[model samples]
Target: MGRKAKHVLLTGGLVSGLGKGSVLAGIGRSLQDRGIVVNVIKIDPYLNEDAGGMSPAEHGEVFVLEGGEEVDQDFGVYERELELILSGKNNITTGKMWKRIREKERRGDYGGRTVQYFPDFVNEIEEWLSSVSQTTMTRKGIQPADVCLIELGGGLSSYEIDIYLEAFGRLRSKYGKENFLHIHLDVLVDVLGQFKTLPIQDSINRLKRKQLTPDLLLYRHKNEINSGAKVKLSETCMVENLFDIPFLENKEQLCGFLSKSGVVECISEQLKLELKSEKGLVAEWKRLHRLAPEPGKVVRIGIVAKYNINHDAYLSLTKAICDCARSLRYSVEITIIDAEQLEEGLEAAIAKLLIADGILVAGGFGVRGVNGKIMACKHAREKRIPYLGICLGMQVVVIEAARNLLGLYDATSTEFDPETANKIILKTENSKENQGGGSMCLGAKKSEILLEDSLAKKIYKNSFVIERHRHRYEMNVEYAEALKEKGVVVTMVDEKTRMPSFVEVRGHPFMVGTQSHPEFTSSIFTPSPIYCEFLKAALENKKCKTSMGLNTTNE
Candidate 1:
């Protein structure tokens, strides 16, 4: 329908985890800030339809966006950096790739020909990118925006990513060179006090071998870009110099670097977009500051997660939590507590726990540090502290309550209950024997939340609601009636299947556990309904503590 699509593919030369996600995010933000509507797609090399059922420790938490698609963490980066919202369509893994190919074959869409990897597989990727970018418009929905940024997961050298590289090369011919911009992300190592371009040089050489040359190279490192390295790189790679590092000391410097490279102006001129002042986007970031409470009075919330250091792991959830914080006009401070680290004394953990007005145990798979999360939830419930649980988090709370209150000492999930006689976990009839990826409800599955006149209803303020889910193990239905008798209110259920979706205590200050994930529903302009309530509770708890302290002081 449209003339053609402007495309940008990001690939690396060396290994994985090279900050390619961040560079793409930065460019996405810079363009969107200048009033250029940007769309992003993540092409993961894994051979799964979705990252579902993958360990959060290994594959990172699967992010669900508005359209019920499970995407990569880059979607979160793009949302935070550019302040735009995307759906699962934004993320495409090799797993998701083959799924489409096999479906087409099943439908006889391949015209009875044996569909092999080369042309058929490669064409699926190109078709996916074009279809997604064209359909979901970021702003105003005018012709799929000015540019679509696509990030290739893993490195360019990986055989898994080779198909993606081939697709891009074919796309270049189809869309024309002017309609596409290739960006290669790499690091600039400062070895022995002199910048070594060997790493970057090797990366570029590999891309050249693939017949895909980078239009711009984003060098991401914790150092300055010296003139000599820039020249050597430009002459060798024939790339437009666009160095991106997080060393912007001032506004003047940032504006200068952006203007000098003609990044904003050039993009504007090429895409026929109006170059609005950077202040428009800068103004949006300032809104975050304005929403924060006074510095010392800010509330701290503890995020007990499996992968605490990998901030990318909790991208969408963190953004939703922050969005909730901003909605309540309070500056929120997040303390990352690795679930593995909580094996230490509960007395020692009390300092951090007491400092936090509210505690959130995020979603994760496996049993590596599950005991810590269960312990944290128990402390919150027993201490009457505000708490929120999501997905597997809800399951953890149920198991915790059963063990401590209901006298089930060895309650565990089916995932970990291979030979244990006291395993409280049960397997889904279909999922019990499935292999890997995409086993769970990775997409949007609607479960009716019949909010009773309890704390759950007060926070949600709605009787019936539906949300997304991505997990294999759930509170076993055989044990569900028993748990319900022990005062665990099943606040929500799937109308058709009659499965539990949310559970909570009868009366508490603030506590909720939902089998559905509300993080995917959160956006920049609109916070997730659950997160909004959680932030309100956290802020209100802060206010109540402040009032009580003042009263005691006056007495």
Candidate 2:
């Protein structure tokens, strides 16, 4: 309820990866637990609307919010811990700003005044950030939030991130130091069994160059922080309120440390705002909980994807699955299988699929794991196991059907093979060639659900619903007839774009593939329509196990 927002900007020192996002989310979660309405802003240094076009192997998977924001994965942690849904305004990146500035120019909003970098570009970015902060608070039915967490993406000394640095400098003056809390995530390396403190010093030097010093120096390491190591880190970093927190590599202690260290309380006191806990909200949410199935039966979901190798990539999905499982009162176990690890002849893989209560090929990019996912889909279709494919997973299902069921051996996504003979999944016509940063379906776009008494319809038990999307390629309409002929039902089409959006298998207990990333739209209390149905199918499988007298185990 202050004129100036309580701002916390997290910036990394030295190299890029230092778990700034984790720290920010941890603090937000701790404060929200105290009943504070937290709004997070993720400002990526890269020039992109979102991180959608980036490779999952290089940058990790783009974590989408319930409102369909293709944002940095840290937002996933924030939403999961705080148990709140963030709108599209929660994320910002260089590409998003440039596009906005260009649009303003095109609309003649500048009134014939030519825009320049300093006051023009920087000012626009600042305005955008403030607007997002205000708008999100207004939408949440709370007074302007007691605190706003902002993450400056990449690192402090990033040459490419100069605009963000300058913008923050101006913002610091606007809010004054009293309302601002700066935290730096510093990484220390171990060279020849001795922990070298050079990285921490060099990191602090760069932050000093921006005329900003951290209120807290977070030494990121794996295990416990030793006294010698702490002294060495403090000597190098030399911050007033230095604290040692574990890296996100081990995320268990993240929330606890933030709460115990008084980081949330410190910020609230500095910002002169009352700290509110979300415990009441969480308890209220718990009160409305619908129990899952009895412990007699269990459902096992095989989530096949490239990012499965790292649990962080699927954070939001894991939360949603847990929520869905709780809703049905069914004991659910999710096994993450690396799609790229599939072997030839697939008999062993098929055996794994048969044991699963349902098969889910999750969203990812590249050809590295394509054939393996396609193989899983083929096995699911053959064995009649409940199957659910999302985003890139849906493309895999469509590609599999195009090749085996429809006899198109060359079916492929243009992202994998631009010159493939059967480009069953083509890039949007408006997409530019060779743009990696943001040239993709970046925001929340709706698709219509047309039910036909199919599995998808039975799961939703309704028609005409909207879900969020973040994908560049979609199934080619030319292959729609062929797929339908093979009993692969094209249940839903893009209402506005008239594109092929969703497909379901005929007579299958539950088999639905959507071009959109359904994981982005799922929440702790409210599951997306797609995931709700997937859980329903998973529950059915668990009931079958219960009928077989198999006791459920919650592992």
Candidates' lDDT values, in order? Answer: 0.71, 0.72
Best by TM-score: 1
The total number of steric clashes, by the backbone 3 Å criterion, in model 2 comes to 15
Q: What would the TM-scores of all predictions be?
A: 0.82, 0.78
Candidate 1 residue-wise lDDT, 358-462, digit = tens: 889988777777888887888878766678898878888788878987788888887876766556666544464756644465555666656567666776677
Q: Give candidate 2's TM-score.
A: 0.78
Please give the range of 10 consecutive residues that has the lowest summed lDDT in model 1. Answer: 250-259
Against the true structure, candidate 1 reaches a TM-score of 0.82
- Tell me the number of clashing residue pairs for each predicted model: 7, 15
Model 2, position 265: C-alpha lDDT score: 67
